[model samples]
Target: MPAAAHDLRTPLTVVLGQAELLERRLARDPSAPVDPAGTSASRARRDGCETS
Candidate 1:
């Protein structure tokens, strides 16, 4: 169980970091349309980093 949690940690860290960044950007430019579900904005930020 610990190993599984550990394995998931890194990816979750990356996701959380991306989410934090997106939250900032969204706070700064909150005009961007976002899905009501919230994950869309986070995925958009992650995708932005992936492209770059």
Candidate 2:
């Protein structure tokens, strides 16, 4: 299972980075539209969608 976990590390890091990036952007531009707001509720719903 370590290999599987290791394989996921890169993608999980990307997820966290993207979340951080979204947070930074949202902080800079509060009024900007970011899909469903990236709130906990919205994030839970958006977790499944593939990003570019």
Please tell me which predicted candidate would have the highest TM-score against the true structure: 1
- Model 1 earns a TM-score of 0.53
lDDT (0 to 1) per candidate? 0.64, 0.62
Alpha-carbon runs more than 4 Å astray in model 1: 34-52
- Candidate 2: RMSD to truth: 6.0
Worst 10 residues of 1 by lDDT: 43-52
Q: Which candidate's lDDT is highest?
A: 1
What does candidate 2 score on TM? 0.53
Clashes of 2: 0
Candidate 1 lDDT (Cα, 0 to 1): 0.64
Per-residue alpha-carbon lDDT of candidate 1 for residues 1-52, written as tens digits (9 for 90 to 100): 9788677766766776777777778877767776575664466555653322
Q: How accurate locally is residue 11 in candidate 2, as Cα lDDT from 0 to 100?
A: 79
Report residue 5 deviation for candidate 1 (angstroms): 0.9
How much is 34 displaced in model 1, in angstroms? 5.1
